[model samples]
Target: MSESVVADFVGHFFAAGVRGEPPTGRIVLSQRRLVLAADEVKETIPLSSVFDVKVGQVPAEMEGYFNDTITIAYRVDDERRVAAVEGSDTNIDRFGTVLFKVLLNGTTALVRHPARLGGRVTDADAEKASLKLEHGSLTFKRKSGPFTVDLGTVISVERADRDLGNGPHPVVTFRHIEDGTAATSEVGIDSARKTNLLGRYIRLRYADVQEELADVSLDEEELEVLVALYSAGEGVSLSAVVDIDPQPLTLLLNGLAEKGIVVDTETGTKLTAKGRVVVGQRLESVNT
Candidate 1:
């Protein structure tokens, strides 16, 4: 082939291989193997099927070494073929480049610059300027400047129309992110709904309740557990619930104990009289 033709062929080959397609021809160099696929590989490999690809040679019987062959180590590019056979311990810069390529290729939504702020979200001015959404976590930038809202801190994120110096800044408001009792009651009402409904009464109810509860709340997770406890007839063991880790649960329980919402007696957790009343009142308010 001419030089130009050869270069073009190589480019096609590289692209094909990177996309997991079978190439018209194969290239093998010593222990290295490259297969160009004839067809295009799907966008992303299933996360579950991703396994480490062993590259280079290793001593026989070394852990995670394939057949004890000691060569240049590399991992599988099962997820992102760009670095499918990248060397082990790849430099951070190179890894970042490959990761970016993978993300682009996969067309994933990545947050380049997440919002950084915190505190209560409200119709009032002070909270609005501090509003942000960082990595799906709700935050508010303080009037003083940038500040990170702690994960456990309760905040409101109201969605309003882009202000154009017009009337009532288009309030199509809803709760942005809420945890604790608010989240719990919302989840409960959602769960209690029957499948057959004429309209979206339950969902509308949920939206309204969410907005209301957002106004008055505590730690999101604690409220969630409390709601769960109430739903389970005023008590649930720490082991039964999924999604929440134990350390947070311990902290939440302690917080509730201090607030008199939960009593940690030797018999296990039961809502204090005040706790029951608080939970009931919250539930009633949300439902209304």
Candidate 2:
């Protein structure tokens, strides 16, 4: 596969994670192969299983954590099973105080620390997870809380805390599930409305196309330009490709050319091999 294709696949994989689907893609982070898929994951490393859990405040820019919060980081045997729960006391009306109470009760959930010999925790007999120090690794899992988490379905973890003045209240930030990252840079904002709408369209259309449309590296407008050029079947000036103002179209074409997706020749503008494949995939998508 081409580098652009690989980048696109990585972007989509991250995007899918941000969107909360069991992502199916291979990303070589730090030269390690991490595979995320729907059913099973291979050669994946959990951030918590390998790292240390630090209790502090999540950055203000990190969406959910407004006041104070605690974070857990460890590497899991498989990176794909990562899950996070983030909540704050401020939104108690919406998210409840289960996660916050866990932090206050000083009780850890059972899922955080798995048994050496794998076992299961059922709903009826579930208990709070405790922090266990084993072989230089700290492990624990949450027990009684609002979240009904499946051990096999987690992919990332985040936690937030709020100071209710009397004491510190904690919340769980569920990071792996799709919270509309594609629709908004930060969650829980007015702009998220539009982001969610566009995200829904991408999710709906993503699976229909073939020829590895996993990563096209083009935004909506760039994709539109490529599609128009492909549909024209001949070299078309930048103006003819889009109805929008000329300056933005020129910038988009320039960006595509820099990415090796399009070429600007003396004749006019045309799709490169990569661009053609993207256009063709999109075309097929529209037809089907």
Candidate 3:
């Protein structure tokens, strides 16, 4: 099979031995290796050699010249070496994300899509998939089709031990938004290193989403109203569900709407996408 190109960009490549101005080159990333081609020299680094990838941070030796950088640490000929790439701030950030995924590409896993939906267990069966990681998302390519989860919409990720035909082992279960509804997925990687690394990366990214939600505070009554709306779905009398009066329930729903958590449709009030994410987080927190 031919190696697929993962990413290609024009950036300045810097190495420890290079003096003065670094070489401006076209950086091409493939499934097996990375190639940097400049005017006179071309350097190829195998992806397997890459041990660490650092984003948004310039190495000490490469500092003072560039701001946004992606430093790649690898071993060549059994000797440790480092190379830095500099580009536009956004490009550097995006390339770093792609590079990180490329390093974890082709991981094998058993995937279960829609393992749960809105507190209800789903009937989907787990199947083997080839993991494909991308910027802000990861894909599970199964025999039937491909299923992807956007990390930005992820609410919670937890580690558990489960038996999937084989003996009980570590698995990762995460809750995310699918078609504007809360859903859960489970994955069991073939190797320990890849599994834990994938889990840690997802949690780190989810932490950013949690930070944005930090300023969003809800009182007990408000939370009760939100949960009621989430569970009972739309067009129901939320006041009856939560044992609150119509007047107070209306006020609570209005407050939630203002916070972009709930929406009042023509027929009834419903939880918005953000509302589902919040409720999903709450449910996962309670379950775990």
Best by lDDT: 3
Candidate 2 vs. truth: CA RMSD? 22.2
Sorted by TM-score (best first), the order is 3, 2, 1
Please tell me which predicted candidate would have the highest TM-score against the true structure. 3
Q: What is the TM-score of each candidate against the true structure?
A: 0.24, 0.26, 0.67
- lDDT tens digits, residues 47-163, model 1? 222222222333233324222211212224532333222122433223322222222222111111122212222332222232332221223333445433222222233323333
- What global local distance difference test value does model 1 have? 0.34
Q: Which stretches of candidate 3 lie over 4 Å from their true place?
A: 1-6, 10-26, 36-43, 51-86, 100-107, 112-126, 132-135, 143-147, 158-163, 166-184, 191-197, 237-258, 263-268
TM-score: model 3 vs. ground truth: 0.67
Candidate 1 deviant stretches above 4 angstroms: 1-217, 234-236
C-alpha lDDT of all candidate models, in order: 0.34, 0.36, 0.79
RMSD of each: 18.3, 22.2, 4.8
Worst 10 residues of 1 by lDDT: 185-194
